[model samples]
Target: MPVSFLSAEQRSRYGVFNAVPDIAQLGAFFHLDADDRRRAMAANGARNRLGWSLQLGTARFLNCFLDDPEDVPAAVVDYVAEQLGLQAADLKGYGEKEARWAHQEQIRTGYGYTAFAGEQWFALACWLYKRAWTTNERPIVLFDLATHRLVEAKILLPGVTTLERLIAALRERVAARQHALMATAPSPNQAAVLENLVKVEEGRRVSRLDRLRKSPTDVSSTGLVKALDRHVELRGLGAAGWDLSAVPPGKIAALARFAHAARAQAVDELAGDRKLATLVAFAATMAPQSADEAIEVFDLAVGDLLRTSAFKATKERMRTLKDLDTAAIVLREVWLKIRSVAEIPDGGIRAALDEMDLAAIHAAADVIGDIAREPDEDFQEELLDRYATIRRFLPKLLKHLDFDAGAAETPGQGVRRGHEVLQALDFLKAIERRRTDIDPSEVPADLLSSAWHRRVFPKRGELAGTFNKSAYTVAAVERLRESLRRHEVFVPGLRKWGDPTAGLLKGAEWERARPRICDELNLSPEPGTDVERWAATLDFVPPARRRPVRRRRRPQRLGTPGQRRDRQGPPGAHRPGPPE
Candidate 1:
């Protein structure tokens, strides 16, 4: 694409040798003055001062512009000058290259050197910056190409390296630091891990600085310490836990190793704790190797510990808590634990459930009802078993507490218990239907009918009306009648008409069937004067037909009569009237 095809905004987005009326028209692409013009002519016998301009333009096209004015190496400057055939001294003050550098520097603070201290440093910095920039919301490894050394000098590698090696090293360092950051979140045993990480990192830094000090040339510890600080900050719980991959290799690796060790120790300590020891022992026997494996152990152990603890606590409360309200709350919590936590084979779970007061169990009925309403298909069998178990014990529990089903004082309680009974029956019926081999007689007919009469039927009757006069009442009765006539499993536990415990009256099959209404009454009025007169009126006649009127022929005057006689004689033969 031509440079002119690029818009002003697009031109500004990229570094250019000249952005003006045209790329050729840029002031930076020409000799600045007569002195520079003479120097160009002497060096290359060129009128347009093409040498440096072409080199600079090519470099710019390659996007070598740096933010720092002084970051441009002295070698690059001299090389470009030499390539242009200009002697260093002649090009010194008047060179357009120098002028461009100066202009950029004044505008952008650091526009001089567009590269790092060396090609190796530049490559490493570029790799780190690009990785950090793309992967994170903000890059922690701050560097500007215009500036020669934004980071400490030691952070840069010692020599020019292949892109592959640098990239490999960069990834390894990042991975290690990321591993460390993963452990930065404070935990119950996090203090020990944090101390261990700091100590290990500090020791590594000391060894690195010691090595640098003994080197043949002077080396700065500034870069090493900066990297150290960045890694250590992540160890602090309050730190944002930003990616520390840009940190130097030695420090990041050391931190990662220590963090892993510390995490293992913390897990061990947690496992040994009284609350978690039981679960921890189970996990340890599994022999997990990696951090994820160990963490998984901790998660399972913690969850198990919490559940067991909750079950025990709730059981204790049910045993000791005298207040019915308080006991109900504890029972609810225990029931939730039963639903969510894995079952323990020990009889303690049952013993705990047995400890609940009658009132508490009554409250738990609500939970059971909810489960029945939205049955989990995955655990339908298990749920049915649980419902059956609860149903078996519920009556005895209520009996022991002297529950009064007829009392108005606790009407809500009775209603709640009745609802649970209905749900239990409904669940049993559903399970029995699924298994065709199971006889309908196996269902608890008395319990099902009692639940209907006591709970389900009453509410339905409220909507249907006792009089069975309203549309809702008539519709509900009609539905029942249709079901009975068809011998369908309309009523719970009444699956078949032949079932002995169906609890249906003998004649209901015939009584409930919809009655036929084939008789029609005569609506015609008896013939009378008023009726006949009404029938004779236009209002009673068909609208599409009208009664015709006959016209009377009139006699004409004497002269007209004589002519009329002649006309009448002809009319008797052939006379025509207006078209009907």
Candidate 2:
């Protein structure tokens, strides 16, 4: 499709270039068209006679209890009534759904709300829309304008959070409670409850401001522009009254010079003494759609407000551009926090988060954020060089870590553990299932010959991680050897780097050292008695072999010292008696 024409759903989405449908046309099609193309609104003068009383307002909703705006924007009301089959007055005490219905009714019964009142999308559709950057950072949370309780927007961006990060961080905490029922897990619940309470308290003001911005009637109100404009006009008057000083200028240059002076004056008046702080407060409550424009308006409003403040206040609040060393640091910190978690997905944001890149993230954020901060040429040059260095190095580090972590957590490891734990668990389950009558023959040999018995792993940390600092090493041969040893099987497949007879040992001692040797080789274990030891020792075996000799026995026990000695080494290596 060329995309110039709207699909029924596309029109309703109002998604702009991003594939949202225009709601106006979509509604007409679904309701008026009888869900088909030809049946859609046919300009039937006879059917249009069906009348309605309508109420209309911003797409943003209101508190059911409060009442105001008595003039009630009659065109909006009438339009809403025609679409909704109700009067503008009838839609009071309703919600966002109701308000939208009313707006649509008006669209069907007559020309839409824009033909009479104004377009809801006007401010957002223009240059002012850029301010959404700041507003989107603030969630469109709601608060009781009265009791300061949750009335509409949530007090926090995640007014409800799953706290996956916090819970993951407390791995030790979970481990400590292994012996206790997990249902009794207390720390996560307590932390979540406390965090939510604090967020609600700190975020109420932000939510309220967001609610206000959602209302187009309020944001673009002539009253508001005038309130802001009064400061602009006063500053313009001040600039006209000022001495031009000895700056060279053509007519355009002179105009530019004057405009700066005027704007400066306005900014001094409004922002100098926190005069437009209230608007800033409002800008902070933003919904994603309206926030950017609202914040831009706030900036414009604040700049003008400050420039026109009393001269003394301007001198105090604006602060000279020369003293920005500390200001730069402050701005950087603020930008980092703001950019790191916002949904914008900009480069500056990528740099602030750890998962992206340590060096690159920092460098990218600095370049994106550090426009006017550095005064020292040398320092600026040094920073730029450092940024480049870190950018190159961090991506390398991130890639290496990603590859290493991924290798460690492969599905191979998952299958290895499954054969170990699940085979055991299922075996236990089967034994329990057949406990009443047991027989060795009844148990299939396949059960003992399963992958659980064949696959082995050496100690962790000692192998996969750095060698010197590691606590344990893991290897396939060692793990298999252990599995075999636990079952008292004969060790056979044990090899030194997959070669038979590569190392010194051959028999008993060789068997004992096989797993340790196999740890180095990454080979599977041969199931055998003392298999862990047998397989491990095989790599270390001496070339000499000896035949068994008959001898008298002292009544032997499983724990006797003769049994502890290497049974396959030179016959008399650890003699309890004459060579046997």
Instruction: State which candidate has the highest lDDT.
Output: 1
Q: Write the per-residue lDDT of candidate 2 for residues 80-137, one digit (tens) a residue.
A: 3455444455544433333334434444344222221123223222312222211221
Query: What TM value does model 1 have?
Result: 0.20
Q: What lDDT score is found at residue 331 in candidate 2?
A: 52
Task: Tally clashes: model 1.
Answer: 12
User: Relative to the true structure, how large is the alpha-carbon lDDT of every model?
Assistant: 0.35, 0.31
TM-score of each: 0.20, 0.12
Pairing residues by index, what is the TM-score of model 2?
0.12
In candidate 1, residue 466 scores what lDDT? Answer: 27
Q: Give the Å shift of residue 227 in candidate 2.
A: 60
- Tens-digit lDDT track for model 1 on 317-386? 4654445455456676877766544366553655565665657567665544443322212222222222
- Model 1 spans with C-alpha error above 4 angstroms: 1-39, 42-50, 64-115, 118-167, 181-457, 460-580
**Against the true structure, what is every candidate's RMSD?**
33.8, 41.4
- Model 1 worst lDDT run, 10 consecutive residues: 211-220
